[model samples]
Target: MSKDEMADFLRRRRDALSPDQVPATVTHPPGRRARRTPGLRREEVAAAAGVSVSYYERLEQARAPRPSPQVLAALGTALRLTAAEREHLARLAGQVPLGTNAVREPVSADAHRLLDRLGPIPAYLVDERQDIVAWNGAAVVLIIDFGLLPAKERNAVRLALRLRDTLCSAPAGAQGEFIRQSAAQLRAAGARYPADRVLGELVNEFAAHSPDFAASWRDHDVRPLPMLRKHLRHPELGELELERQTLLLPGTDLQLVMYTPDPGSPSAAALARAETHSR
Candidate 1:
């Protein structure tokens, strides 16, 4: 177990929280001195985690022994960690199995063939981190043109947070929901691959610049990508409504996302028109 990294993670998570966020069950000293740091005191965390103050202090100071699984679970609850965060904590403490950290598999040949055969449907592939790996032509025409973007800028979360004005054309509520889900997915990916420096940098960048993303991330919501309706406006096609479906390629972390228009709906006609226009 890397005590130093674990200690740093614990310290950062603690510092990020405000006093008001702590549970009501945690109480302060009857005549507490004025606090210097804004976050919870060591005693407060200890009280909430059901650990001794000295033990928690040793943990934060990186002087403690390897924490037991029970201790880790208690600490996770005390710190209000998400499911992903709790699992990450266990992995860091050497209590859980650690898989290939930060290593992403390439898109399989079968996935590439499927993408090709799904002609005129807006379909694309994204890695666990939501980075665009490959996209079909229909995705380029309907969604943001992935082919035109630099590889670094092709991430779904980054585009939603940083370039929403240019890439999003949905109602305010739909847009908000989309962004929230993106942030939550990114948070899950961060926990799953804690050693992924690129994911770390992307999170830092989004949290630094996007208040909406930062707030959603802090809520610790871990939601699977759901099949949902998306309202989009195209310069050429006017307004279109489509349903987005997510398909996980078996044995891989890649997600195949496809947008489909309901049969016989106006959206279908619009897509047909778009397809013909490209010919």
Candidate 2:
């Protein structure tokens, strides 16, 4: 099923609960008005999932990142979801177990330190599936601030392919090439971890929604991480031509990407000017 199906199914499940079954329904803030909406409110589910209210809403909207297994378990318990309902929730969230040895590595401390030291350079980290795991302040200001995005929107693949991120709006072959690389990386992940529910859901969603991605897959293109040049047109910074470098972190599936302007290029001046305006 598509993310649309997942969203609708989650809404229906949330509505099925009686008012008494939810904690928020039972305990009201002093002298607050009775809840106007029927069924468990969004806050109720978020509290149960141990995530922020906005994050949970994004999940229902299918715009956030997939929840981890622990968060899913909390959500299942909070919603009073049965065993079958839990399985359905897993499928909807794109968080079904990958396999027996499936393990998600945390962003290493060294990765964090490296990004921090790459001053004035826009750098961010991505997982094997293109999930934006970590990013620096420069990354946020230069890029689209993936930190502020909903969990589901944190994936580079989703943002570039489906969500129409501004970075991809540049008039260059870079975005098109990125799409092809994305397809190849996804294919690699699927081969290595066939039971990865997250990858499965992502591929299904892309196959249904993105014609370019579908075409890339149909062509069976594969490319390794290479030093590629990208041009970006920012509303605030004008034209930027930067060299993209990908460094694979040892002992993890994470890759650090840094965008550096060539010396004496117009992009260098633009980046310097934009730095003053950056967060």
lDDT (0 to 1) per candidate: 0.78, 0.72
Instruction: Report the number of clashing residue pairs per model.
Output: 0, 4
TM-score of every prediction relative to native:
0.68, 0.60
lDDT measured at residue 226 in model 2 versus the true structure, 0 to 100: 56
Show model 2 residue runs off by greater than 4 Å: 1-102, 162-165
Ten-residue region with minimum lDDT total, candidate 1:
97-106
Model 1, residue 147: C-alpha shift (Å) = 2.1
Q: Per-residue lDDT of 24-133 in model 2, one digit per residue for the tens?
A: 53336467567787888777777766789998898789787767889888887877876655765675566664432247877778888998888778889888778889
**Each prediction's RMSD to truth:** 5.2, 18.8
Question: lDDT by residue for model 1 over 1-279, one digit each (tens)?
Answer: 767667767876787678778765574556777668887877888998999999998988889999999999999988888777787677667787655455566777788889978876889998877889998777877877788889999987777666566655578677677767778777667666767787878888877877777888776556566686888777777788998887877777788889899999898898877766765
